[model samples]
Target: MAARPLDVAFKALAHPDRRRLLDLTREETSVGELVNATGLTQPAVSQHLRTLREARLITARSDGTRRLYRVDTELLDEVRRYLDGFWTDRLGRLKAVAETIDDGTTP
Candidate 1:
């Protein structure tokens, strides 16, 4: 079976360098700028950017002779939705326990 989009996004985000790239892309930037910010070689930065693009986590647009890249927040919203389930479940359980304790229902 093929990996789901969320799975692909998670895999792409597994690398610290890729995560750093995402952080740096809070504003649109060029590959060369990313390389300088990351202190990574051009090839390495390109490789990471390619993976991020494939995962739909980032987008590139041609500007004059340069390509500007930025985070694709809509796709990132999917990732956030997927991760939120775990936190939501845990928080719900904690809230229930807290309510039980407040009601003197814990034994």
Candidate 2:
């Protein structure tokens, strides 16, 4: 993902409450259900949902009088790929350090 998009995804996930909301909405949920489950006000849930949608982490569908939200798999894939880069680099550094230690570089 682009730098701006990465920033948006990170910011959206920076909140514990938003993360919980995403967990609860993993299988499609409505705003009312999320508010009830999280004990947050409707407006608060709506605001979080808006952020998630804006970050492309969640998708919404209108169902009669209510709108249901679901996680966006493709968006998550992009986020995962971005994070995986860090993992790959960290693991490589760790391996190098381990090899050096084994070579008597330091105790």
Candidate 3:
């Protein structure tokens, strides 16, 4: 069976290294630059980039010998929308409970 998009995204984001890589890619970066910035080995940085690519969280383009990577904001927005639904509902319920308490109402 294939994994869901959200599951894949969450898995990709589970690692701190991967998250850091994503943050660095916000401005279109190469593997060498990532290694220099994060103090990680080239192979390790590449591995994180590969996972982010698979998750569609980042995009890559070849600029001659160097491959540039950038964050995929649309995908991140989709993930955020999915997570926001839960928070919105939870906050709404919490507000209702608080209002009830203020009114001295018991359920």
Candidate 4:
């Protein structure tokens, strides 16, 4: 079965290098800038950018001779919201357990 878009995004984010690329692209940046920031070869940076682009985690545009890249914040926000739901549920359970402990009861 094909992976969902969110699954693809999570997979793409699994790499530290790709995460760094996303961080660097928080501000609109070029491939050259990404290479400089990452201390990676131009081709390596391009490959990372392609992965991010495929995940819909970033957007690119032509700027004369350069290609500018930026994070697609909406998609990122969707990912964030999905993750937050899990945190919320876990925290809620923790809170319940804490309350039980405070009341001298085992959870």
Candidate 5:
């Protein structure tokens, strides 16, 4: 079975190629353009784009004979929330450690 949508989104972003593809989608692009930017085969770029679409990280539309992709703002917001929470959680733990150290607890 496949994972949840959030898991799938994160998995898609786990690949550097896919992350770059997502970033490039910020301005809408065709597979050929991404191929040029990443120095990958057109088919490879299309495959990565397919994975991103499946993960709902990007959306595509027909621009004449070419397909153009755009970033899915909602998904990006969710990703931002997840990353922000991770940093906030880490900071909380670090703060606790600092407080304990200030109390003269040595380790």
Candidate 6:
């Protein structure tokens, strides 16, 4: 069985190195720059980049001899919206429960 898109994205984000890579891409960046920022080997950074690319979280473009990467925010926005909805719903429920308690009603 294959992992869902959301699952793949979350899995890609689960690694500290991958998260750091994403953070570093706020500006267009190269694998060399990523390696320098992360202290990982070029091949190791490439591996993480491959995972992020597969997850649709980052996009790469060739610039002469170097491949520059940037975060593709659409998928990230989708993930953020999903998480926001989850939290909003849960917090709304919690607020209702608190209001009930304040009213001296059993929850």
User: Candidate 3's C-alpha lDDT?
Assistant: 0.91
TM-score of 5: 0.70
TM-score of each candidate structure, all chains considered together: 0.74, 0.72, 0.74, 0.73, 0.70, 0.74
lDDT tens readout by residue for model 2, 15-89: 998899889988989998998899999999999999989988889999999999998777778877979999999
lDDT string for model 6 (1-107, tens) is 88888888999999999999999998999999899988999999999999999999999999999999999888878878999999999999999999988889654
Name the weakest run of 10 consecutive residues (lDDT summed) in model 5.
71-80
Each candidate's lDDT (Cα)?
0.93, 0.89, 0.91, 0.91, 0.88, 0.93
lDDT of 3 by residue, 1-107 (tens): 79988789899999999999988988989889999999999999988899998999999999999999999887778877978998999999999999989889654
lDDT of 1 by residue, 1-107 (tens): 89888889889999999999999998999999998999999999999999999999999999999999998888878767878998999999999999988889646
RMSD of 5: 5.2
Q: Measured by C-alpha RMSD in angstroms, how accurate is candidate 2?
A: 5.0
Per-residue error for 101 in candidate 4, Å, reads 23
Question: What's the lDDT for residue 93 in model 2?
Answer: 100
What is the alpha-carbon lDDT of model 5 when measured against the actual structure?
Answer: 0.88
lDDT per residue as tens, model 4, 5-96: 88899899999999999999889999988888889999999998999999999999999998999998777798789899999999999999
For candidate 1, give the lDDT of residue 72. 87
Off by over 4 Å in 5: 79-107
Off by over 4 Å in 4: 80-107
Taking the tens digit of each residue's C-alpha lDDT, what string does model 5 give over 1-107?
Answer: 96889988888889998888878878988888889999989889989888988999899999899999988878778878999999999999999999988889665
Q: Kindly indicate the candidate among 3 and 4 with the higher TM-score.
A: 3
